[model samples]
Target: MSEKFQKCVEDFQCLNCGQEVSGNGFTDHCPNCLYSKHVDINPGDRANNCRGILKPINIAPKKSGYTIFYKCLSCDLEITNKTAEQDDITNFLITLKNQ
Candidate 1:
């Protein structure tokens, strides 16, 4: 789906694990499992409309970025997100070991 940038609201329930999630303006993953659903093509923009379960598959440390890989649980959509502090979760360390 095409993307149109817009502001995002918080307190969304994770479509993957059915867990309640909140975005303090920076969070993008479920706190329980570190998984995210493909809700937008651009960050904070509700454009993709896929509503697919985006699983954390791998992690890559960039020279000036933090990468998190995701594969959708429904349509196999893939998405990558840069790390953010408000995105703290227990599964982050485990994801880093993948790559």
Candidate 2:
């Protein structure tokens, strides 16, 4: 973890897909919808007040996993996050390609 990263484990419902998500101290985005909330300035810090919905815009493939790019709906802030192991990334990519 980065020095600024804090580990917080909390469950939340996915704002987009309404999936019940269980946090594993590193969970940020919803695995089902790949959408996250603008709640953290640093990972797990929850210091940001924008409270916007972070929509996954693009996916960058990596050797191990992928990096997900996002844009906040309310604040329009752009950010990137690593995909979790269980993330339904293929569906998102397919949806993106279709669009």
Candidate 3:
């Protein structure tokens, strides 16, 4: 049986940007880089074996906040995550545009 929303809170270093991330239970990505790891089959379950780096590609604005879109570097899997309070979406978009 697969579990959903396991609520695992752990600190991690970003593989892409080398940022030390402090996870708050719901943290699935780096606030500095908006990058995530493909570590869960379901939210917080950490059951996925891919272990891919999920790069932020785009964002969609919503009423509450924004939804971040990501694509896995290793497996090309696409996913979406809601923006965190500390996420630097503006800087990311600016850097993305400059690239």
List model 3 lDDT by residue over 50-96, tens digit each: 88999999999998779989899999999888898888887688878
RMSD of each: 4.5, 5.1, 3.5
Q: Enumerate clash totals for all models, in the order shown.
A: 0, 0, 0
Segments in model 3 whose C-alpha atoms lie over 4 Å from true places:
1-7
- In candidate 2, what are the lDDT values of residues 1-81, reduced to their tens digit? 554434378788999989999998888789987999998888678888787999999999988789989999999989998
Tens digits of per-residue lDDT for model 1 on 1-99?
845546576788876568788677677777666788688778777677687778888777877546888888888878898766545545667655655
TM-score of each: 0.68, 0.87, 0.87
List lDDT for all candidates, in order. Answer: 0.73, 0.87, 0.86
- Output the worst ten-in-a-row residue range by lDDT, candidate 1: 86-95
Residue 63 in model 2: shift from native, Å?
3.2
Clashing pairs in 1: none
Q: Which residue pairs clash within candidate 3?
A: none
| Two-way TM-score contest, 1 vs 2, winner | 2
Q: How many backbone clashes does candidate 1 have?
A: 0
Name the runs in model 1 displaced over 4 angstroms: 1-7, 15-19, 63-65, 88-99
